[model samples]
Target: MARARRTATRWWRWRRSPLRRRIDVAEAWVLLGAWLLAVAGGLLAGLLTTGTVERDLDRQRSERRESPAVVTTDAVAAADQAPVKQIGARSVWATVRWSTPDGSAHTGRTRVPPGTRAGTTITVWTDQRGRLVDEPLSGADAWLRAAIAGVLVAAGAGGAVWVGGRLVRVRLDRQRLRQWGEEWDRIGTQWGRKTG
Candidate 1:
């Protein structure tokens, strides 16, 4: 049937066909290389990107430190601003004081629950200079964050590589088309120009 002939002609580059030209063989090789690059290169790039991301996150987790402190005074209760439907007690700035391991006193203003009274023992994280800082991420939270980052990095790297392969494929296809056109131009004149 016509379908059988179409299928037979489709992969002529992979078979012995008298009509197949040098360009056909070149295109087949180019396509094979493109596929290899898309798969192997993409995977390599994705894995490297993922490892780099996870290591950086681990470094950051190590750099951050944690400490405990106490609220110095009762936090001023925030005024209920009309037209604003607040979900929870709006946090208010309050002075909190804590001492270093050497008993050196330090104080800083930090957000506290509204109406929090002074002397309420509360723990607060601090930095190298004992400045108030957010708590370090827990182990589970860090893993979740790292996994999401890895997935995004992998997708981005793979997409870039896939696009590069497609560009190469398209260039090969254009070259093949131009070569076919040139061959046709040379032979068509033998048929009386336009064949009219």
Candidate 2:
């Protein structure tokens, strides 16, 4: 029991020393601030990203259900028939307006070449449900955009955490070293004269 009390008293004295106390408090604050900032920024980014994804999904669904038919077969429309746009060397899109079998007219854009005109008849493909699908994009621009955004967010958050930890560690190390030096000096003065 006496030994335990001595150990406790020594520990209390070391901790109550001014340098050690400041070091401990600074370390605690750094860790707390780092975690809090990360969590707050992560939540904000997640909410905005989720909303954007939902909106895009809704738009795609609507397009799939109501868009015009894309050309998939050989078509022979008049030279002045359809509004065509060149997407690539071999790909084109034509805006078409036609009446369905039930006498209801709908207009949509179709992917085709520059061969049809404004008033000519052209043969184009229609699915069983008769909805147009836009031509798919060829590159990875969409994925690249998302990846860049993720990297930016990660870099910002990681930098904050690193800086906070470094500051805390440096401050604590200085305080601990100073206190240790003082303790050694006191011990030497007390024992050196007695042993002499």
Candidate 3:
């Protein structure tokens, strides 16, 4: 019963009462609208961002291809070059030459296993234009990226709505306070007892 009374008290602005001022009603409406917008807007933003990211990943997977390339230079151990290991293997940068389907050749630098000798065949990813490119994300990776993007976009959208609502509520509160001060001044002057 106590909890029910507290809930009712909390919603007093919505109840019809002589004490319920216009500002109270306005504040209640603002709170409700902010909650609704935050939920709906967050959901919409999340879905759109997720879909866009997934589609882009899918397009990349479709557009990129792998080609065999020959190592033009021996690869140096990554530990010798950098203090921190970048990946699983001690990979090092080396120049590689590859031929496109159109018989055109291209040379690019890519990471290769440490101590990789020249003339070693290695698979490299490329775009439609035959330029060397990073391999497209795997299925699991794409899903993870999309999920993260969706969550971040959703949180941002919700936060923006919350901030906007908070600003409006603060302005309303200030206005109410100013009006109350003016009313009190008038009433106090009539009583011949002015109080700051």
Candidate 4:
């Protein structure tokens, strides 16, 4: 079958044949090494990136806590703040006050629903010292983010190896072409001529 010939041709570099140049054997080894590097480097980079990102997110979640705060100013509609399109309930910046675990009061500006009046209690996230902070992602969300980062890093590593291998192969092909061209030039001029 045609497949049998194709299989044999694939291993031609290892066979004894005048057509097999040193560069051909070297190209085979280069390709093999490139594929191996891509696999090994991709796995290492992916695991390292995923672990670092997940650990950082986990640390953020552990250091932040939720608390209720009282808004001291009326919130304006988001439309009034800007002309940009917004989805869901309109929100605005309003000053809020909350107490720390040590009974110390702290105030900061945070986003609240439009039309919210003074003295309305709203849930907020804070650091250990009661400073207003953004909420952290849950474990599942963190894992998902890490997975995406890992995949991108893995793909990048593999792509770099593939590109490097292609460049090497192109250079080798040019060398072989030049060699053939030189031989053909010498042979073309000697047609039907005898030299002793």
Predicted model with the maximum lDDT: 3
lDDT per model, in order?
0.72, 0.55, 0.91, 0.87
Of 3 and 4, which scores higher on lDDT?
A: 3
Ranking by TM-score: 3, 4, 1, 2
Candidate 3, residues 1-196, lDDT tens digits: the string is 3554444476888899998789989999999999999999999999999999999999999999999999998776434566665566757888899999999999999988888988999999999999999999999999999999999999999999999999999999999999899999998888996658
lDDT, candidate 4, residue 140?
92
Q: CA lDDT of 81 in candidate 2?
A: 48
- Per-residue accuracy of model 1 over 64-171 as CA lDDT, tens digit each: 665577887777533233245356756767788987666788999887777788888777776666677777777777777767776666667667766776777788
TM-score of each: 0.70, 0.37, 0.88, 0.82
Maximum-TM-score candidate = 3
The per-prediction CA RMSD against the true structure, in angstroms, equals 4.3, 11.2, 3.9, 3.2
Q: How many backbone clashes does candidate 3 have?
A: 0
lDDT per residue for candidate 2 within 58-141, as digits (tens), equals 555454433333233333442234365334335344567655556676566665556545554544433335544543322354
- lDDT, candidate 4, 57-168, per-residue tens: 9888999998889988777543366566466656778889998888999999898887888899999999987888889998899999999999999999988998899899
In model 4, which runs have C-alpha deviations exceeding 4 angstroms? Answer: 1-7, 77-79, 83-87, 102-105, 128-131, 192-196
Give candidate 2's TM-score.
Answer: 0.37
